[model samples]
Target: MRILLTGAGGQLGRTLIDRLPTEWDIHPFTSGELNITHYPSVKHRFLNLRPDVVINAAAYTAVDKAESEPEHAIAVNAEGPALLAEAANQTGARLIHVSTDYVFDGNKSTPWVEGDTPSPINVYGLSKFAGEVRLINTLPDALIVRSSWVFSEYGQNFVRTMLDIGLQRRQLSVIEDQIGNPTYAGDLADFLIFLAQKPQVKGVLHFAGNETISWFGFAQAIFQAATAICPAYASMQLTPISSEQWPSPAKRPRNSVLCSLRLAELGFPSSDWRARLSEVVPQLLAANVLKKAN
Candidate 1:
């Protein structure tokens, strides 16, 4: 299959570039190379390439910053996917777009299912939800995967941030009230590739790590994993605090755990997040060590 991937410079995009099936021919584009916000550029590129599948991994992910720059966020997150769907429709290509769990209000006690109505509380979430609506309206067959708390070896994410901060500061504060599943970008990339080959999968789907934890709990796990590789992280202190204690420009959902019932039914099993973290933390610490030496 010929697959065209957007956001190749991002965490998920980077992972997908490395993990995509070797048999498939990939035309990867970073935002700098092909800005999704510019429909003429995206459409022209797609028409020429004529890919069998188009995976949109690009997004405006600054949750708090979106409050101040809603227009920019909408242009990238909402308008971009819609334009991609239009191009894919003209080219008769399947589209797999990545969304977020933030679409929900985060008030539910149980994990969110695909059928749940979205009630986004923040500009970032609202923009993502809008993107989903736009894509579905343009192409009903488009596959939309909604995930949460993504982290990996590449890109700016919570895991890397905590590791860097924990090494530099002896003490830190993390919000304990917010809870959600943390996804491994590598695993998500693998699944997206699996879906690309399977034409049967359509509509909204949920995929996330097996376990759900708060930011504070995730920090503890990160430190535990890092300390084994680098002793300096062992002395770091992580203080658990409430969301109100650390106010942000945008309001976040208190609970945004996604239930991957549909994903499990499709035969893709969920992996333990802590186990995945252990595998990644060591690599991250090793990279840090090498960076300091140079």
Candidate 2:
């Protein structure tokens, strides 16, 4: 089957390129290759490729900046998927659009279920939610996977950021209020491949990492894991701070955690995020983000 992939440059998109089966035909489109926000470009590309499926990994993920640039966020995140869906509908292709936990308000005491009603608290969340709304209207069968805290060897993410600051500064402070699952890009790719093959698995799904923790708590794990990987991390000092203490334009989810019971039942078993982190940290470090001999 022919597969058309957008946002071929993100952390998840990079991993998806590697994990997708070599047998299938893949036509990758970068930002320069395809501007999804523009309908003419998206329609032209889709008509040219006439792919069997379109996996849209492209998104404007600037959370803090979204508060100020809500229009750009909506155009890229919300409107982009709608345009992709239009192409997919015309080409009679399946659509796999990636979404985020930011769609939720993060007030739930428990992890969010697939059926939970979304109430995004910030511009980013609202934009993503708008995308979802348009997708369902455009194509009822489109697969939408709602994930959280996605990190990988490539791209700018929390894991790489923490590793950088953890090594560069003796003292680093992280927000203690936020909580969510940390999913590896490769892990997410594996599950996506399964859904791609099994077209029946359409609609909203969650593929969050196996474990759940607060931002500060997750930092402690990162440093602890770093120490395990590179013993030198024992010398690092990491501090915890409240979100109010470090003000940002956007209001992040205090309880961004999501429940994956539905995902497990659907055959996508959970992965040990800590164990996965240990495995990938080396690559991230070697990728030069850490920049020290491990």
Candidate 3:
């Protein structure tokens, strides 16, 4: 099948590219090659490629910067999906648009269902929520995957950040107040490919790690695991501090856990996040993030 994959350079996009079989005619386009924020340029690609599937992984993902750059965020996150939706509608291409758990405020103790009413607390969340709304509004048949704390061995993410700090300093402080699941981008990429093959997987579905924990706990686990997995990283101490101790320009959800009984119902296997994390840390270390070179 001919497929058009946007944001071919980001962490998630890179993982998707890695998972795709070389035999498939996949047109991976970075922003310089095709910027989704520009409607005309986006339409041109769709018209030219005439893909059977369009996987949108492009996004303005800077949570703090999004506060000052709401227009750019909306243009890229909201309007970008709408433009793609229009293109998909015009060419009869199925869209697999990625979304976020931030669409709903982190208030629910239980996992968020597909039908939950979104109440975004931050500008990034608000913009992403609008993107989901716009995508559904434009193409009702499009598949929207809401996920959280996406990380991979290859990308700039929390896992790499922790590995870097642990390598640099003997001691490190991480936030303990915030809670969410950390999904490995590789697992999510594989699931997206699986979902694309399942005709019943259309519409709003969620994919996340099996367990949820606070950022502090997550960091502590990472430090402990890194030590076991990468002996070079074993001696460092990871400290947990409250959110009030560490302030940020934007506030995130106190809870960002997303429930996916819906995912099992859709025939996707649930993954234990710890096992996934265990698998990814070694890869990250091998990639030299543990050395903190760049």
Candidate 2's error at 10, in angstroms?
0.8
lDDT of 2 at 155: 92
lDDT of 2 by residue, 170-286 (tens): 778888878899888888888877888888878898888888888888788888878877787778776788989988898888888877656756777775688888877787666
lDDT of each: 0.92, 0.87, 0.86
- In candidate 2 the C-alpha lDDT for residue 186 amounts to 87
TM-score of each: 0.98, 0.95, 0.95
Candidate 3 Cα outliers beyond 4 Å, as residue runs = 289-294
Candidate 3, residues 1-294, lDDT tens digits: the string is 888999999998999999987888999999889899888888889999999889999999999999998999999999999999999999899999999988888787777888898999888999999999999999999999999998887768998898878767887788887888888898899888887676556788888888888888888778777989767677777678888888887888888888775776666765577888888888877777535566
Tens-digit per-residue lDDT, 146-254, candidate 1: 9899999999999999988976789999999999999999888988998998898999999898998999999999999988987888899889999999999999999
Query: Could you list the CA RMSD of all candidates, in the order they appear?
Result: 0.9, 1.9, 1.8
Ranked candidates (lDDT, high to low): 1, 2, 3
Decide which is better by TM-score, 1 or 3.
1
Question: Model 2: residues >4 Å from true position, as ranges?
Answer: 289-294
